[model samples]
Target chain A: MTGWLSIFKREFRAYFATPLAYVFIVIFLVLSGVFTFFVGGFYERGQADLLPFFAYLPWLYLFLIPAVAMRLWAEERKSGTLELLMTLPIGISGAVVGKFLAAWAFTAVALGLTFPLVITVNFLGSPDNGAIVSGYLGALLMAGAYLGIGAAVSATTKNQVVAFVLSVTVCFLFTVSGLEIVQAFFPDAVGKEVAKFSFLTRFNDISRGVLDLRDVIYFATLIGFWLFLNRLFLDNAREAG
Target chain B: MAPRLEARSLVKRFGPITAVDHISLKVEAGEVLGFLGPNGAGKTTTMKMLTGFLDPSEGEAYVGGVSVADDPERAKRQIGYLPEGAPAYGDMTPRGFLTFAAETRGLTGAARDAAVARAVHALSLDRVIDQTIETLSKGFRRRVGLAQAILHDPDVLILDEPTDGLDPNQKHDVRNLIDGMRKDKAIIVSTHILEEVEAVCTRVVLIDRGRIVFDGTPAEFRGRAEGAGTLRVILPADAVEDAVEQFEDLDEVSAMDRHPTPDGRVRFTLTGDDRIALINRVTGVIDGAGWPADELELDAGRLDEVFRALTSRETDHQDSNQGQEVRA
Candidate 1:
């Protein structure tokens, strides 16, 4: 109905316009199955839940979601479509938000395709469906956070590979902030504070069946901050003068 | 009536270098102003600022009387811009791209459908409407970009080199498209092609190094040439010596050159500071000498020469290199 919505529609369709969407979905489904069955040992653990499936999502998205977000602004700039898009009567924020929302929804679709996992877990045993939903919601929010960072980084350069590599590095730091290897570099107080920001730490609680209000608020704030940076970066992305 | 598109003292600076400096002009409805300049003359940068794609370091651009900086959305709504290179979504089909462009401009339902249909028809894109933009020929791709720009029929149309990179027939078709729309919208076309300016523009604004050097009608622009008012004549070989003697006696004739033709005729070019007086004197001398002139013609001046004279040549290499690097 409005500008962002139209932008959203076009960008949402753009994902499927190329092989990017199907390829991403297939890769996601295959790796998801492999990670859950072979590595996480969904069967060997004797657990009837999808915990192992959800456990490997962050790592999978660390590489995969950036692939989606890498093309968001990078391709627009590379193809010179940014000139056309920016000249339209839409707000810069609208364009940024629209593309982000499209990427988020597309990733959600891939996450939704894991319905077989949901059905498989349900058929095997009586698992806590509510916690599973919460886990799914948490995964979606975390992906959005990763996407937010990737979009901002993509806005910084027209090169998609640079966007992808930089986004992976940045996302990696955020994912590992709570690990002891990273904690050794900071003072105890700063180390504890930094640990609170880790995707692994925040997600650990939410995936365990407790949707903490603080965790949700944290993800929301992180997304907002990065998207705000994305808008700023896009404005500067136009060749100066 | 107020001009449909106007810029007031527009200036854009990338750091210390002034890309567009104190540029100002206005285009009323029914006037197609040709923005003529070389590659690095800041034509594209000015168009970008005017279209609200880039902010000016100083000054303002207005569309339908609404300031681009103050009310960009409203001003932009009245503008249809075809940016340089005619960039469009490569993955999108022409049909989808046009629909998306129309919808983004807030055209919906019947209006949107009608707009897209009209643009498709106008650009003759019916055949390629279903093809992805990347797969279409360059001409078709450019037409798709044009269709997207005109989808809303905004009051002001700013096209950056609409015919660039097209074959001659494609160039002709694109000019016809611009000509057909000239009467309804105030259009500004930036091009280095001198022939295109005469083909579609009602007026010419020549800028060089971010400054307006000449702004006038095409004839007036051409009148700036060194030999604009010169006269040329062909005399039979038997009468050439007599005509040369008579021409030298006239006070108005400042210089003259005789060129011998292979057909046993001698051609003479007469130049003077005062065109009207010189024409009168030259004719009197020819009549008095009773010279049989085979052909006599007045030179209207060469557009290429005029273009070169008005625009400085030294700015070519360095500025063009900088312009390309600055564009993307």
Candidate 2:
């Protein structure tokens, strides 16, 4: 427990120890505000709920979460600290999960700061707080899903810029794969599978106030699968030096 | 009790290339093993396997009796390693990093605090404990890495080029640290500094081409130099046959080579480790034979030459003067 828990404590504190946490939180709050009020037309489409605000959380996370995760393994690899970290007594899986949870919790904090939208909606009209809770839950899961992919991609390269671009590209595919237009690029049979696996589709489902067990399990497995790949890459990628 | 650390026929292969080939080592407590090898000779790979950071391709490494491959967590718990570059977290302060190392190594509460304090004091990191590692100088960062490795005070410690980038004073300090801890920990240190072997290593293992070419005491390594007790003896050509017979029979002469000088004198070059006695014996033989000889000289022995001779031809970059230029 000390080995695993200490990694979580260290990585989490590391986020706040530098300017990264403040910068990320401020940017996240500003962008979510801009996209919600002006771009998504939160006021004009007001039926007394945060649907307009929740609609763009996926797109906002598409870039921001990767920015937070770009340094996860890429920075370690670049500075050669990956060797130091791996040689520690902590199991690699524990380190991976701890690091991933730290990032997830940081994003959750950034997402949590958007509670003003819930307040504004409830003040204006009768809003279902339960749906707002589910929306936040779905958004956090989607962010974790994005972070999982970003961390795995980050493990593949030492250049953080390359990690950012690769993560954004992969996450974008998972984000829009279920869209009607994007699905047309695939064969009819393959298109259905792509839709079923699309992250935004799951987000939309859970945010609608119906939290299916399978949907929760799907997101969990997605995060798990990416984390598993992240570990495999670390095991082989760190062998060179 | 089992050896503190051991590597049994450890082999690591990348593609068709065998980085560490059939390497086996046993490091017991109270011994500081100097891992001597030129660059690309697989010193880093062997240490990586011993620490359970890299799995061996063909064999096993044991840290305190647990096989690293079969149970890396338990094996790794007993070994503390510093990789080739002494990598550290640049964004973390020394205080934060050492505390993290202590906690991860399973030290908690007062014990963890004491361990961190001891490591910091041992490495003299008190001045820059709060400084971010990236902002610290290279020497300080290297010290921070050492502090992290030794915070737990494991029974087996493996450091790769621990003093690679330090100044003379810092090098002496690190050497003393290793020496001070040698009574309890089995340590393996890989270095290109030939003098460090003499200063710190209880036994030296000279590796070349992924194989152990020479393993012995430092004195033995020096004796194997190109000219430990080498002598140049010039005598009349008529007496060369009789001199050769007498010199060949003497056990003091390990090897002898003959050359014909332009002045019709024969020069015999003799190599031996018993220097004082070799000179005395050769001079007596010359005096007893009633043969006038000239130009008798002995070399003081060169360790750098011995290093290159024992390694491979790839060591052309090695300095002949000494360890002044033997950088890996």
lDDT per residue (tens digit) for residues A16-68 in model 1: 99999999999999999999999999989887788898888999999998999
Where model 1 places Cα greater than 4 Å from the true spot, the runs are B229-298, B313-328
List the candidates' TM-scores in order.
0.88, 0.86
Candidates' interface RMSDs, in order? 0.8, 1.2
How accurate is chain B of model 1, given as a TM-score from 0 to 1? 0.80
Instruction: List residue ranges in candidate 2 displaced over 4 A.
Output: A186-190, B229-300, B315-328
Tell me the TM-score of model 1. Answer: 0.88
Q: Write the per-residue lDDT of candidate 1 for residues B1-328, one digit (tens) a residue.
A: 6679999999988887787999999899999999998778899999999999899999999888898998888888898999988999989999999999998899999999999999999889999889899999888887888888889998999999888778998899889988999898999999989988878889999988789989988867766877876889888888877787888988888899999999989999998766667778887777777877667777767888888877756546547677565432
Task: In candidate 1, list every pair of residues with a backbone clash.
Answer: none
Local accuracy of candidate 2 as per-residue lDDT tens digits, B1-328 = 7789988998989888888899988889999999998788889888888887888889999888898888777888888788878898778899999999888888999999999999999999999999999899888988998998899999998999999889999999999999999999999999999999889999888888788888877767877876688888899999999999999988888899999999889999998877767888998899999898898887757777788888756645444545665433
B-chain TM-score, every candidate? 0.80, 0.77
